[model samples]
Target: MKKVLAILLAACMVVALFACGGKTDPTPSADPTPTAATTPGGEEKPTPGPTTDGVPLGKILEGDHAGREKYKIVYMCNTLAWAWNAAIADTLGKLGEPLNYEFTAWAANNDFDAYLNNIPAFANQGYQGFVLGIDDTLAQASMEACLEAGVSFVAESTTIMDKDGLCIWSSVQQAQVKNGGIAVQWLYDHWKDYWTDATLDGQKVGLIGLNYSAVSGINERKPGVEQKFAELFPDGKFFDGDLAALGTTGFSAEGGNQLSTQIYSQNPDIEKWFVVAYVDDWAIGATRAAEQQNITDKTLVVSIQADAFLAEMSNNYTGNVYVAACAVSSTEFAIDMANYLVATISGVATPETIWPEWNDAGGSYPRIQVEGTMITRDTYKDYLAKQAAMLP
Candidate 1:
């Protein structure tokens, strides 16, 4: 009825607060100062968890708070099965002990009732902050509940907006349009080399965009790639496997492989393919499909999040079809959430205060988008070295 999965996803974040730990042993980066504080109810910091050197605040903030005086708070989010979510969850697991944070991550498994129930459960259980990635339409009641409970809140992936088309809370993640455009820029510069024997009239070159339209953060990625492809190759043929439209989760690499296989199979003439995927898993799927069809040399893929790409040690560009990926740096994003929440609770920053960038840009609610960066096989080693230094 559906597709398949290849994730070695840990059960860590599939449940509520304080349930599990990360697979990593990340230590905190050296700090100019050591942190020592308690949560507002005089609760202690340093919960039982992994150690982490924090990403460092620009300066020791002046106050402990959002409007109340507090040092730290419990942070939670939905879903750990997804790589991005898992990375965030792992960071939470590591940072809590050193930074005085109480945090957890897990999925609701698409059960809306179970998802909505956590919002109230979090408040009832004394949690003071959350980074939620929820359905926009279903967010109002939960968002209202968080506001009423005085929970410092941040939206993950997409900003929670009010009925009047205004944002209600700060959001974390990349600018969707720009994130997609990264794929286009890479494809525009590189597609030609891959299209050597292909011809537009012969229907040999196909541009495929893998769509995950269910979430605004991901859905917004498709248009940027599509619009750019049209302008650059006016006669090009583009195809899609809109997973949301097809009523699929759009996550599994195997699903990606199956969907892309169908696309390539139907258009047998499409020998040179360029796949722009919203995430790494789908991109890997498309790459696998190209390999299976023996067109690896003529296919190229670019997507957001280098999670899977980093796991592969081969020369991903020359040795494989998947070429590039972008990262929101799950580590950095997780740290920013902690910093912003503490800054708000300690009275140094307002709910509208733009973190990391420190400016609201005149928006009612802050939409803090981590700039995305392209990573290729050529540079993954450096990225890995940096990760090693940070974690060790």
Candidate 2:
């Protein structure tokens, strides 16, 4: 079953590459200069589709109406404060232009009740399908509401357990695990340069974790990072930052800043940090704390969600200390998701057969895990260059 899915996924990726006009060169670097020249502000564009002359790119209909108007779908975001989330919402709305669907997004501003309330409200408006940024505690309610309304659903970033949802999509957990390994390897390679007497045995590393109680995908990533660290340096010390405590204030940049500050004060000797957060604001907050505490030169942060930190990562000052990130393109994911929902609604595929992860019998929810890109200064610059070429 897994093998069949792998072939299908590979075929999809090949199709994606060709759709984007093909891949770039074989190598990318840590330097900020791009191998290919870039057009200004064109970095990381979304996947291409039939947007020519405003003709909506609806798929060839076969089952019911062969040549009809596009369907309507709506998306609800958990919060738009995080740039990545906003980008995801925006991309979905725009991609509908070519895909023969009406796409709209609503922001819940991280309010749990607001997030829960919006689901039924959106469904009541006659949307055929919904793409949701999930809050696990409220997911069952949301799913029930959609079911009652007779709307098909697709969830992102988190999964709905034991529910009959169409699909659940998120960034690959294995890439996040590999992100931890990359963090450790980077520290090992450059330890001597940072500290003359630095040794792997007693070196302290701090982890800033995302709250993962009901969010299993993120919960799974934490152990992978920890296990890899243990494998690489058995005697190294690790400190964990309290994510629940951080949420007391809020979940925005301010909350992140306060949490990082408190963590830094408690673990003053820790020089390296690994953030198991998909939101870039948390990592940026940690860097901001490093600056305020006058430890910028002595600290390094390895994290996920690179788009929000692209500008900082490209600059020499912040770039040096920021180290690396695991990047999942919001635009690409949004495009993939929009198409998946359209395909399911159009009767081209079912939820289980849409992607491979959905076939796992033991898991309560069917899902698709998409891999991410590694972002260093050079690779980020290279990404920008490639995106520029794809324009026009």
Candidate 3:
């Protein structure tokens, strides 16, 4: 009986040893793949979502209007006989169908009274939208008439006061101001060290003001440069004492040539000449005048608005022509306004004002401020390529 009890105790001891060994090293099972072990500080990272730089998705989605009915819009400009008119016509043509709209242009040929008289005529013709490239003097009354007729009105490159709910103003990216400031800043950055210190101190920068009678954009741009120069050089002489006025009408080149000739004749010592004109056509005229006197090299010509011809000249002359910046045509803004009108007619929330106050710093607007490209001879090829890419 004692031997039988010993046998049972020995079996119990053997079972206990097997159990302890299994906990330390278990036997391999049918599925022998090892499981992944978690580390002491293991963590699973989450995936990232999408993002835009700063523009809200709501603003991006705001102006979309699909399957809307067609609408008729009349675009009025102070002078319908120029490149600007062509730009407006082309822009409107592109906006057709997609926005369901047709634009008719009424050019007043720079006559303020004629522009005012044509408003009611256009409204009577069943037009719903009116775009005005107005003379500053006629803005208030024309805007008032538009409000009275319940026709939505938009002004390009200018604004009229006292019409809060009636008018939308498209602000071109202050191209005139930007171009002027850039030209001056370029001179300061690149050529200031070259000028004799004494000459640089008293250097006279002459501004050739164009369309003094009718052009508002040119007028605003001149003051921007003047103010910038004042800020940069507190005691610098801004040769405002010399003013050469040119008309944008027929013979703009001739007018530019005549004015430039007069300026050179009166103040030959002027070192830098900043032209406040719409295009290189005026600069071409000034170049002709400089050629007549064999003085092209003496003057540093800085002008706004660059087309194919101006771009080529900038390449050839290098430092003589100095800087060329673009004041992109108002045509794109006209197209945007047409699209906005279609959206508004379709009951979408549209801006009451064309040039909203927020767009002063290149912000949002029905009439967004389109910026100009600044080009020098070194950068002309790249500028041309970019403009070419935008064609289609």
Tens-digit lDDT string for candidate 2 (349-373): 5555554323334433334443455
What TM-score does prediction 1 earn? Answer: 0.77
Model 1, 204: alpha-carbon shift in Å? 4.2
Best by lDDT: 1
Cα lDDT tens digits, model 3, 204-232, are: 65555433434565565666567766676
Looking at model 2, report the run of 10 residues with the lowest lDDT sum. 32-41
Which scores better on lDDT, 2 or 3? 2
Q: What is the C-alpha local distance difference test score of each model? A: 0.62, 0.55, 0.51
The sequence of per-residue lDDT tens digits that candidate 1 reaches over residues 87-189 is: 7666656656545555656466567677677777867877776767666755676677778777777766666777776666776655567667667778777
User: What's each prediction's TM-score?
Assistant: 0.77, 0.70, 0.67
